[model samples]
Structure formats: structure tokens, C-alpha cells
Target: MNSARESLEAGYARARQDAARSLETKAGAVGAIATEGAGRDIGSTLLTMDSRLASLRRHSHDYADDLFRWHTVLQWLGWLALALIALKSFLYVLALELFHSDERMTLGFDDAQPIEGSYRTGAQLAIDRHFPHPLITRKQLSNADNHLVLAPWPGSSPLVRIIRRRYFFFARGSLLEDGGRVATVADTARGMVASAGGGQSIVEWTLREGEQVIFRYKDFFGASDNVSLRSELSLRLSTLLFGRVIFHSARCDSGEGRLLLKASVEAVDQAQLRAIPLERMIAWSRHAQFTVHSGRTPWKTLVNGFTLVRRDRGDGQHGLILVSSEDTGANTGSLRYLKRIFSSIF
Candidate 1:
């Protein structure tokens, strides 16, 4: 600004000097017997005046150009700031969605033949003809897979179904109603074994080398009382999405044989997951990871898989059904993500 002002003022001063000189020459020519010789060439004088006027115009243009450049620079900076703000807002929204989410998973039992169905998360789940709702009752099933495992879909909005959603299981001559016992689950060559009650009831499962494509729990219903069990089994292995998962819930109903399970779940390993997805988009639910452990040593450690202990004698007595969310050992992954988010915000 200072430079422009100085240059512009100099240009005006030069023009004024030329005009004054020209006026003096013209005055001499107007007088009779003029003193100044030839009144200083009129053509030369006019040329000088024109040149000075041009220089003034150029200085004015330069000042205007400088102002215009500053304006453009400011506009670009403003736009950049706004774009950054928008991007940050979008990321925060996605994080909040994951936090508020409670993925749905429902694993139950049903009788009666299932209605015709497809294999898509958004497709209608084939409803059991005898039982229409999502329930598990160990009754006589007619030509249908008894286990009803609803797939885990983190995409579904729990808020939409928040009115009041609860699941139920009716067990006749089964331990599901009794909440079972707390036992140690071990993975051995014989099969996956869940031992509780000092070896009173046994639950075991075995799998082949490959994954199973199509199988039903009813076919092996009388075979075992265990599903796919693994070691250091975190929810990370599963195809899970939205949700700050806290704890997982599972129920086992042993009926046909003294709660006697000696079959391998690996045979139909794909089947349980398939059943979960069996009515996913249609039913929406999600649980399978557990923090329940052997009652012998409380809070010290949890058995690798589901714990099968004696029946609950009182309301909060008996076994370990609930897993504390604050358990760092069980919730390492969940806590890490939460910590990262809060750290950025605060």
C-alpha cells in the first residue's frame, strides 16, 4: 500500500509540473511581442503532457491490481478452512454411529419346517411354520433344523427396535432354564470339551479339516451341546461391524442325553454361523463372545469357551453369567479404540 501510494503521488506531481510549464508557454505566445522564443515548440509540449497522463493511469492500474490479488488470496484461505471443518465433522459422525450401536445376534431353537428363504442380509428370513417368532423351545421339530441362530449384523439400527426387545428359551429336561454350570472348556484332539460339575455332564465337539457348507443343528441335535469354541478367542476373528461391543451372551440346552455331548461342532461349524445369518436382515441380533469362567477361581481367569456350571440357586448366586465391562483383559481391543477417540476429542 505504501509503495503504491508513493508511486501514484509521484505520477500526479510530474503531471502537474508538465501542465504548469505548458500554461506558461501558452501565456507567452498570447502576449504581443512574446519574450520566450517560439513559446517552446507546441508539438513537443503536447507530447510531454500526454506521456505524463499515461504514467498516472499506469500507476492507478497497478494499485488496483495489487488490491485484487489480496482479495483472491483471502477467498482461497477461507474456503480451505471450511473444507477442513467439514471433513472433521464427517469422521466424528462415523465414530458416534459405531459407539451407539449394539449389534444384534440371536441363537435359539425352533421346530417345524422353515419357510422358503434366501441368503442375503436384507432378505426375509424363512420363518418356522410352527413357531413364527424368534424363540427357542426344545419341542418336537418336524423336518426342520432346531437351532435358530440369528446372524450378527452390525449395520442394523438398535434404536429402531429399542421399544423393548428380549429373547426367550423354553427348555424341557434341559439345563438352559437352570442357567447350566460354570466349567472349563478345553480344545483337545478328541474334541472340544466343556467340563463342569466334576464331570457330571460333558459337552464336546470336533471339526474336520475343512469348513462345512450346509448342515443343521437338528441333525446333530442329539450329538453334542457345544458350538465352535476357540482359544484366545476374541470377537476380532468374526466379521463384525458397528458397535462398541461390551459383553457376549450364550445359552446351551442339553436334552436328549444326560446333558451328554460327545460330538464335534467342527462338522457343522459353518452351519452355526449360517444359522446366525439364517434370519439376519429379517431378525437382527448379535452375542457369542463370553467372559464367564470357572467358579473355582473367580475373576482370576475365564475358561477359554462357555462355562457350564450348576444351576443358579438364587437371583445373583450360582455361576458367572455376567461379564464386567471394565475388565481390561477381556476388553483390550474395545478400550484401545475408546481411548484413541477420547484422546483426540479432549
Candidate 2:
């Protein structure tokens, strides 16, 4: 009986041990499954974050592209608006010309009467109308055709005087009025005749009585010949009077007349400037040319061309400024011009 009882207890103990091993094994397998599930969840979260970041980056690129497109559109619109203004000005001039022509025909107006006073007469009239002090007619020049007018500006030194003259009546000419003291700017062939002692300029432009063409020049110190930039500096056409423009600059040592004349002709042809109805190219401009740069670099230096300023003060009086070269001397004939134009225009 004792041996049977001991055998039963041993079998019960062995079964208990086996059951505990199986339970331990199942617990370890469940723990491993749970850990793997947690890892999968972490991986899924990372993938979602990466997708969101990529989407944000795409949105940023799209925004930048849209902004660039908008900027381009604005630039184009600005250019179009400028074009429309120019077109309007052109049409207005055309209509004015037609009206003037019709009136002239109906009234039987003489075409020559309007331009009766040549450039000289117009210039003299302009001076008398604008200048306060009376000009003393100087009889120093020998040329019968050439007339000299001398006037002293208010507050100006005795050394500096306003000297005006009509030159190159029939092309070939010579100025012998105090030879060394006078500064004369003749045709390109003549250039300028001046002595060490600088004096007032005598500008001899190729001007006709009633030719309505304005020639303006400017000089800039750069490699790029920015014609568009220069055009912005020109005088605005207030009426149907001014149109057809041309610009040219050769080397500092360029030959006179030929090159400039050629360039002007080419420009007129290219732009068809003849089609425009013009009245006169007012020749009340300075003729003297001064070298701004030092002697060393004189061969090639930038020159600001010319600024044409017309001051019409409601009365029949008119003031004109044709600055061929830049100088601001009160006596050199620039301050008077600036004063006249700025007083009216501004």
C-alpha cells in the first residue's frame, strides 16, 4: 500500500511540471507577438509623417511658381499701357494736322506766311521777348549775312557776355571777330575754332527756315548703347509740332559733318520721318563744344547728347534750350536756358 501511494504522488508532480512548461512557452509567444505589433504601428506612423512632409514641399514649390507668373503678368501689363499712351499721342497729332490743313484751305491761307520769319527772325524775336535787357547789335563781324547781338545778363561778370550770331549762311564761312578771343563751332569740317582763352560758343547747326525736324544727342559712359534709355530723356511733344527723332555718336576724333549727316539720313529713312507734319526746327541753340574729360582720355569719352527745352509762356514769346554738351556756367549760356525752361515747365 505504501509503494502505490508514493507512485501516485510522483506522477502527479511530473504532470504539474509539464503543465507549467507549456503555460510558460505560450506566455513568451504572446509577448513576442505584442512587441511585433508595436513595432509595425511605429513604422506606419513614420510613413504617414514622411508623406505629409512631401506634400508640404510640393505646395511650397507651387506657390513660388504662381508668384513668379503673377510678376511676369504685371510687367507685361505695364509695357502694354505705355504702348497705348504712345499710340494716343500719335493719333492726336494726326487729327490736329488734318484740322489745320482744312482750316488753311477754307481760309485761303498762304503757306509761306506762317513761316515768313526765317529761323534768324524767330530767334531774334524770341530773344527780344524773353530777355529783359536790350541787346546791343554788334557790328564786329565782316560777313554781310552774319548778324551779331551782344547782351549782358543780370548779375553776370563783365568777362562773360551773352553773344548771339547767325552763321554759315551759304556753307563756306570764316569768323575773324577778335580771332583768338571768340569760340566758334562751325560745321563738322570746321569743328570749333577757339584759343587757350575760352570764350562763348557760336553753334552752326544745319538748320533750315521751317524744317520741323529736331536733332538731339546724349552721351553715356557705358558699353551698352541704350537707345531706349536715352529716348526717355528727350523733350515731350506738347503739341503736333515735334516728332521724328535720331541719335548718333562717333568717336571723339570722328570727322565732322559726313558721319553725322549719314547717320541722320539713315535714321530718317528707317523711321519714315518725312510722313510727319512738322513746322520748324527752332535753331536758337548753342554752338560751342567743350571737352569735359582730361587730355589723356580725350580720344574716347562718353558724352550726354543734347536736351531740347521749349518754354511757351502763353504769350507769343518762346524760349528754347538746345544743350549740345553739358555745361552749367551762367555766362556760358546754360543757366539762362535752364532758368527759362524750368521757370515755365516745372
Candidate 3:
């Protein structure tokens, strides 16, 4: 009986040992499953990160491309601007060349009666014709404005001249004319007068029984002495003729002397100087009697003169006449004609 009991106990012990090994194996399997799930989660996270990084790289590349395109466009725009500036400069030079190449002169005339001869006396007519009305009353002329002089010149004659005797000082002169030449001269006792532009000498001439004349002489100090003289003469002639009509007529400047002649013949509500179409006036002048004269002199070397005349028809419009001259240098006849025409008009 004892032997049978021992065998059964041994068998039961073996069975218990087998059951413990099976539980251990099952625990190991469960731990392996948990580790595998954790690894899978980590792989998924890494994949997602890689995808995001790729997307970021793509966006960065697109941004770089856009920036490069903008830079290129800016460079092209800069080149275009430079080209436009160059073209404008070229056009301006061409225009200046064309303007200097043309030789033309302009004259102004009044349709009223001739100023040379009339039924008027000498000094009385001069006063009535030349001098503008005094701006101030006799009382104002006596006031203490040293800048303003009561009388431009202390003379009984109608004509007066304003002179600049210093770098920027002003004086006066008076003259009388006999026939077509200036006879008498009087000047204020002052030092060398200067002005904003330059030094100036002025003379006033009273015709025997006609209009008074104002002659202004400007002397510039520089390399352009000759050019200045020519410009001044041109300006004087222009002033004599058209100064009473046009508000701002054309001017001539030759690197030295600058002359400005401004007139407004609109005294009677623009009666004398009406605004006619430029094209119509040009056409009329073309059809009118035209005469051209060309000559050469020792000084000028080359010269050209043009004269145009149109008689008064039955129409109410007044007749038109124009005379112009262009000389290279020192032929004074054209200058004389300019003076004559101016005298006739004024």
C-alpha cells in the first residue's frame, strides 16, 4: 500500500510543474505582443514626420522660385526706365538743333495812322505819345520812397531814360533828336552802374514831331561779347515794332545778352491785336506780295532780307506788312531797316 501511495504523489508533483511552465510561456507571449504594438506606433509617427518634412521642402522650393522670378522682373523694369530716359534726352537735343538752324524774324505793326508825320507840334506831341500816364498823384511823388523817384529824369521833355550805373544801381538819361539822329544827351552823375543782368546804358530820343524813342544798351562781361550785341539789337528792334501789341513776344538770347520785350496792344479791348488763327495768318502772308533780297558784306559775309506787303481791300481788316533780315555778323543795313520799320509803326 505504501509503494502505491508514493507513485501517485510523484505524478501529481510533475503535473504541477508542467502547469507552472505553461503559465510562464503564456506571459512571455503577452509581453511580446505589447512590444510589437509599441514598435508599430513608433513607425507610424516617424512616417508621418517624414511626409510633413517632404511637404515643407516642396513649399520652400516654390517660395525660392517665386522670389527669383520677382528679382528678374525688377531687373527688366530698371533697364526699361533707363532706355526711356535716354530716348527723351535724344529728342530734346534734336529739337534744339532744329530751332537754331532756322533764321526768321518777326515784326509788329499798328493799323492806325503813321506816327512819322502828323498835324501835331514837337514837345506837346511827344508828351502825348511816348510817356505813359503817371502811376501816382503829385502828392505821392513827393513822399519818402527813395526807391521810387518822382520823375524818372529831371527834364521838361517827354522822353526819359533809366540807366544802371553800378553792379546793381539805377540812374537816368535824357536826349533830343534832330531829323533821324540823336542830337543832345544828359546823364545823372553816378559811378559805373550795374544791374541784375549786367551793365546798361539807355538813351531817350524825341522825334521832331513824332513818337519818342527809348534805346537800351546792355554790355556783358564774358566770352560772348559779340553774341550779346547782336541779341541786344534784335531785342531793341522787336520792342520798337511789336512791343505795343503782343503781351509776351518772342525773345532772342545769345549766351550773353538777354532782352525781354512785353507789350499789350489790348488797350481798347484788344481792338488792335486780335487773336487770329496762326494758320490763316500764315496763309495770307504766303499769298501776299513777297520780296526777298540776299547780299554779302565784308563783315557779315552772308545776308538775307525778306519784305511782305498787303494792301487794304474793301474788307474791314487792316492791311498787313512784314520785313525781316538775317545777317551773319556786322552788316548794319538790316539793323537800320529794323529801326526804320519800328519807327514807322510806333
Candidate 4:
């Protein structure tokens, strides 16, 4: 009987040892799984950091390129200014010797009035006549924000004068300097701030008689459209320097004259002026117009509503005209004409 009890006790002790071994094996497997999961998580985090760093590097490289270009332009402007001073001195001497000695002769004072008068008259006629030709009839939409009239290009050579005017407008707004560079602006204190995709955070404020506004496309450098961002950038910069701010952009729509275009006017301050580096102030002049078409054209005939007339006076003479007429409500004459034309066809 004692021998049988000893055998049973020995069997129970062996069973307990086996159970302890099984528990230890399970605990080790759980620990191994936990360690492997943590390692995978660390790897994922490192990859994300590397991607962000690459983007930041690209932005820095672009910023450096813009700064170099701006510096070069400033150097060129300095040389040009010296040349202009010398020319003015020679003209002054010529005027004194050729004309009367007692009377003061002005270089371009007499010529200014006739050009201004013609511009005003031409703009008024363009609006009243409603000519549909792209060259003659740029319809003045009722919802238009700003009206500008540029003086006719002077001198016999229109190409040279036009080039000068174009450069003058471009340099004035930093548009020439950094307009080609995307929406990203360099902030020394804060690394680089860019909008996701093509949207930006806008601040709204009321504008007075002479303020500047910027109009930016939603997808300026997208694969879908080939619209140039430079024209609008140059126009915005030119207007801001010489006129008031009025932001306008076309909205998407299916039918003809459905949404037309949206306008946003904002007041510019010193902070905004100081923020942009590429814009150089050459001289302030009025009569600036710029337009950018959104790629999505709903109707087959995309009739534009924004009107700021550009007249080419043969021999390289071109001018932009703006009319200060009555705001005659939102139901503009152009919209009425569209309804009349579309009603008969559709």
C-alpha cells in the first residue's frame, strides 16, 4: 500500500512540471510578437519623416533661385537709371538751344492730354457699341470689379516701347521677380508654408479707391490646363502699384452665362507690401488689365464677361481703357444680349 501511494505522488509532481513548461513557452511567443510589431511601427515613422524632408529641400532650392533673379534685376535697373539721366540731360540742352530761351519747354506735357482724352472716348464707345470682336469689343460685364485705361504706347518703334511697358508693369508688382515661382512664399522666421493642392487661406477686408488685389488660379500648374499664370500675376502687380484691389475669378458652370465670375476686393497694408520680395516699384501708372480663363468651359461658345478694352493704334501703339460709368445694377447690358442670342438658338 505505501509503494502505491509513492507512485501516485510522483505522477502528480511530474504533471505540475509539464504545466509550468507549457505556460513559459506561451509567454515567450507573446513577447516576440510584441517586439516585432514595435519594430514595424518605428520603420513607418522614419519613412514619413524622410518624405517631408525632401519636400522642404525642394522649396528651399526654389526660394534661392528667385532671390538670385531678383538681385540681378535690381542691378540692371541701376544701370538703366544712369542711362536715362544722361539722356534727359541731353534733351534738356537740345530744347534750350533749339527753342525760345525765355519760355520753358516740357518734354511730354502737351501730348498727355490728347492720349488721355482718346482713351476715355474709346472706352466709352466700346461699352456703348458692344462690338463682339475680341480686338474691338471686350464686353464690359455688369459684375466687373475694376475699370482701367492705359495710355497709348509712345515712340515710333512699338515693339521696343511695348517691351518697356511690359517690363515696367512686371517689375512693379514683384510678379516679374517671383510670379513664375508657385504660390509658396518664403518666410524666414517660419520655414515654408504652402497650401495643400492649390487652395489658399484668404483674408477679407474692404478696399478704398486705390488699393491692390491679387487673383490666383486654383490649379495654375496642373496637367489639365495650359493657362499662363504670368499674365494675371503681372496684371495684379501693376494694378496694386497704381490702382485699387479687386480680385475676380470665373466659377464653374454648365449653361451659358450661368455663374459668370466671382469678385473679391481687399485692402492692402504695409505688411502685405513688405511680404513680397520680387515686386520692384519703378513708377505708378493707371490703366492696367489682366485676365486668366479657367480650363473648364461649359458651353461650346465661351463668351467672356470681363471687359477692359485694349486698342492697338497701328505703328506699335497700344492702350488699355477703363470707363468710370454708372454701376447700373447686376443685370448688365452684356447679360441681356446673351439672353437674347441664346433664347433664339437654345
Candidate 5:
């Protein structure tokens, strides 16, 4: 815009100079004619030329004013756009860094009603029930809990809602980042599983004699799904993945610097889900499991969801595969849908 204005102004100055020089030459001619006593007849013509030159100058000035106004407006709009982009970026970063919250598993014994049986011993019985073979010593884990404490995961809040709605890519990138490191396609699959698996408690367990508390999957989250979890690691998921799998029930035992985790994957069919009181769609999604048809249409197979697992124990999805998405139930456009899309693809 500035360049165009300068070019126009320069052209106008050159034209004005040329017109002035021509007028001076004409004036000399008129003087000569007057000296010959023949200029009186053309004096009105010179007046008309002068009026036309003034009009041209006025129009050139007006043109420059209009061009300058346009340039200013364009510059303002450009700055406004840049400012909006920067604001969005700042909000996104703030949401990720400032808003992440964490809660861990602990013996909330201070509830202070009245103590009955030993909660730690009760925790032991619960673990034994979940794992008939007992992978850990009775001394390792005695804490009663489950459904990996949603630590470092944003809870229900206004900022979280805004991020999900307006700044979703930031959240998505963070979720994928949860999937640890990746070097090969196999490593990528493992990282993706870890991402989908979601957050856990600070009390990481090792099957050996460790001072951490044990919260079996049953005590916490297994009751919601009503499916019996197997004890051995990766005991249930040894086949192909043709649906978005939710590692809803995982029994992880930390052993010898390695984690042995077991879980079952289920894809929910909301349509066939039976409504339960206020739960409605949520109840259906929770109670039911659906199968995806991975037939001739690879596109549908992908859209529906699936995982590509290698035929090795240590190759895919770490020791277990599960991805969790917030099931904020609704008619459509839930976080669950986004989780399904991402978990299926990666």
C-alpha cells in the first residue's frame, strides 16, 4: 500500500512539473504574441487551461487522501488479526501449563465416622479376589482403590470446557504426548496406548516387596463395567483390534523394572445401549460393548476404529492397551467421540 501511494504521488509530481513547464512555454508564446498585439483573442483560452490544471491538482490530492485511508484500514485489520492469533496462543499455553491438576490414592481414614475392619486388610482381600493367584505379596499393596486416579488430567471446570471447545488441538496434542517416547511404528503404538490409557496414581506398584498401597481394579472401576478382569498381563487382548478399545479394566503389577498390565477393550454402541435413569446415553455406553465391522471397506474399518498389534509380547501397546476419553454423555459431539477418532487412528 505504501509503495503504491508513493508511486502515485511521484507520478503526480512529475506530471505537475511537466504541466507547469508547458504553461511557462505557452506564457512566453502569449507574451510574444502580445508584443505583436495579437494575444487579446486567446486570453480566455489561457484562463480555461489554468482552471483545468487546478482541477487536476485537486483530484490528485483527493486520490492520495483516499489511498492513504485505505492503507491505514488495511494495516489496522492486519494488526487486529495478528493480535487475535497471539491471544489464542497464550490462552492455549496457559490452559496446558496452569490448569493441569493432580489427585493421588491415599488412605482417607480421616473421614472419621467409626473404624470397623482394617481397611488395609480389607484391601488385601479385594486384591486376592481380583487376582486368585496373587501376583504381589500381601505386604506390597494394601490400599483400597481403583480406576487410576485421574491425576494430571483436567477435571470438569469452565477453563477445561473452553479449552475443549475453542482450544481443542492443544488438548489433543497433550493427550498424545502422554504416550511416552516413540522411535518405531511399534513404539508409536505403545505410546498411543499409554496415551489412551490415561493417568494413574503416584503410588506406582512393583509386584515385589514395595512400600506402596495396592488398589485393585475391582475396588475402584471394575464394578462400573461389570466385566471380570483376568489376572495375567495381556491375557485378554491377544487378537486383532477392529474397534476403539477402552482399557476400562486394567490390573497392572509392577515387577522387576517392568510393568505387567492386563485389560479388556470394548467399543460402545450407544444406539443399542439401554438407558438407566439419569444415565441415558452414558449408562448405555458404560454397560454395553459393540463390535466394529472391518470387512471390505477399509475406510469404515478405520472410521469405526482398530489397532494394529504386532505378533510379539513386547512390540505393541507396552504391556497393555487402553485409551480413555471423557464420556461427557450427550446427543452428539462428545469428548468420547474425539477419543474414539484418535485412539482408533494411532
Candidate 6:
């Protein structure tokens, strides 16, 4: 009886052990399923975060492109504004020229009426007009019927005075009488002339009749220390009263004297004399100085020394004179004729 009871108890114990084993295996399978589900959830969350980050990067790139375009547009607009400003300034200058007119008429040379005395006086007048400080006094040496000689006064410099011993030869040629108008040509010659001393220069005029041409020879001599600095400047000032036009051409050295070569063509309508303002005429005259010095070296340096003024004339004609180096003491000439022709138009 005892043995059968023990075998039955043992079988019961074995059954309990087997049941425990089966339960452990089923628990393990369930645990594995739960782990897999958790892994899937985590993977799905990571994928969602990655997609959001990519969208943000795309948005940032789009914003950067937009900012770049905006910057480019602003830069272009800025350049356009500058160009417009320059254009307006140019138009203003053109407007001034179209309206203003005041004319000064210089009497042409006449042959018949006592031109001998006139020529002598005119020569003196030209010298006085050109040289504010005369280094020598001029004396009339000969006043014959057809020929005249002007004696040179003692110059300030002994060397120049000694050189001025030569006589100034003058001769009157045939005159052209065009109806009421008369133009006379005079020939002048001077030999053995020396430096004026200091920075002074002499411009001798030779007028020929048939060609209706005037030749001006400018002689300059440097200081004793700068004898090597010798130069001859020349220019032709031609005017045709019938055409109401004047032309000027000059050749000068490389230094401060370069202003001698500046020349330009300018015209104003004769009919619009009353409408142009004095200031406008003055500005035009001043601006025209640049036309002469547009190219070339050294003389261009004097561009800063220009001055413009409208002469107060009681007559109906308005006159403009652009003076370069207004302080006569400076080393420059009075560009009066230049301003006058440019201020008037036919």
C-alpha cells in the first residue's frame, strides 16, 4: 500500500513540474511579442523625427535663397539711382546754354582812316592788355608813311635790356574795304629780343592780309638758374565776322603754361539775347575753359584756377569773361576773348 501511494505522489509531483515548464515557455513567447511591439513603436517615432528635421532644412534653404535675391535687387536699384543723378546734372548745363545771350562786338581793323597812328596805339594797347607788369617802356622809333619802328625801353633785367637794343619793325599792308567795314593787315618784326626776366613773356603778332591770318609768337625765358627751361608757345586766333565764328588753336610746353593750348567751339543764337541769365552765361564761360584743357598734361593742372564773371555792361550786350588765375600776380593770362565768343551764337 505504502509503495503504491509513493508512486502516485511522484507522478503528481512530475505533472506539477511539467505544467510549470509549459507555463514558463508560454510566458517567454508573450515577453518576446511585447519586446517586438516596443521596438516597432521606437522605430516609428525615430522616422517621424527624421522627417521633421528634413522639412526644417528644406525651409531654411528656401529662406536663404529668398534673402540672396532681395540683396541682389537692392544693389541694382542703388546703381540705377546714381546714374539718374548724373544725367540730370548734364541736362541742367545744356539748358543754361539754350537761353542766355549778351554780345560784345570788337571793331574790326580799318585801313583808310589814319590806321598808322591806330596801329601804333593798338600795338601798345595789346601789350598793355596782355602784360599787367611791363618790364620795359615802349618808345616809337619810326613813324614814316608806310613803315614804323618802336624802340624798346630799358628792361628791368640788365641782360634783357641789353638784348632789347634791336628795333621793332612795323609795316602796313593793303587794307580790305568791305562796304562800310574795313580790315587792315599789319606786319611786325623784331630781332635780337631777350628774355623778359622773371617769368614774364612777350607775344608778338604778325598779321597778313591776303590769307586773313594772324600769327602769334610767344617767347618765354626762364631764370638764370633755369636757362635750360626755354620754350616758344604759339597760337592762332581767327575770326570771320560774316560767319560770326572764331577759332583758336595753341601749342605750349609741358608745365604750368599748358593752359595756352585749350580751345573749343561754342555758339549762341543771336535772337535769344534777352532770355539768358547773367549767372548762366558766366557758368557757361567758366565751363568752356575745360574744353580747351580736356586733353594734354601739365596745363590740365590749372583747371582748378578758373573764375567766371559777367561784366556789368551798360550796353545792350552782355559779356562774360572766364579768367584763369584771377589774381593777375599768378602765372596765367586773361581768357577774355575766349569767354566772349563762347557767350554769343549766330
- Give the poorly placed runs of model 4, Cα more than 4 Å off: 1-9, 78-346
- Give a tens-digit lDDT track for model 3, residues 1-346: 8889999999999999999999999999999999999999999999999999999999999999999999999989989866844453344233323322332432332322232211111111111212221211111211112233344323312121223221222222112223465434332221121122122221111122222112222111111011111111222332222222112111113212112111111112212432331111211111122112224333442233222223333344332311111122334433433333323222
TM-score of 5: 0.21
Candidate with more favorable, higher TM-score: 1 or 4? 4
Candidate 1 structure, TM-score to reference: 0.20
Off by over 4 Å in 2: 1-232, 238-346
Candidate 6 lDDT at 99 equals 17
lDDT of 4 by residue, 277-346 (tens): 1111111112222221212222411332222222222433222222212232332312333332212111
What shift in Å separates residue 153 of candidate 6 from its native position after superposition?
84
- Model 5's number of clashes is 5
How accurate locally is residue 171 in candidate 3, as Cα lDDT from 0 to 100?
Answer: 21
Over 223-326, each residue of candidate 1 has an lDDT whose tens digit, in order, gives 22332211111222121222212212122222111111212212222222322111111111121221212222223222221221122223321211111112
Expressed as tens digits, the lDDT of each residue in 23-73 for candidate 5 is 999999988977766565567678998999999999999999999999999
lDDT of 1 at 118: 18
Better of 1 and 6 by lDDT: 6
Per-residue error at 105 for model 3, in Å? 12
Clashes of each: 19, 9, 7, 10, 5, 5
**RMSD (CA, Å), each prediction:** 25.1, 21.5, 22.0, 25.5, 26.2, 25.3
Backbone clashes in model 4: 10
Name the lDDT value of residue 199 in candidate 6.
Answer: 36
lDDT of 6 by residue, 146-241 (tens): 223243221323243234332233222112124464434432232112223233332231111111111111122111110111112212121121
**Model 6: how far residue 223 lies from native, Å:** 78
Off by over 4 Å in 6: 1-12, 85-346
Every model's TM-score: 0.20, 0.25, 0.25, 0.27, 0.21, 0.25
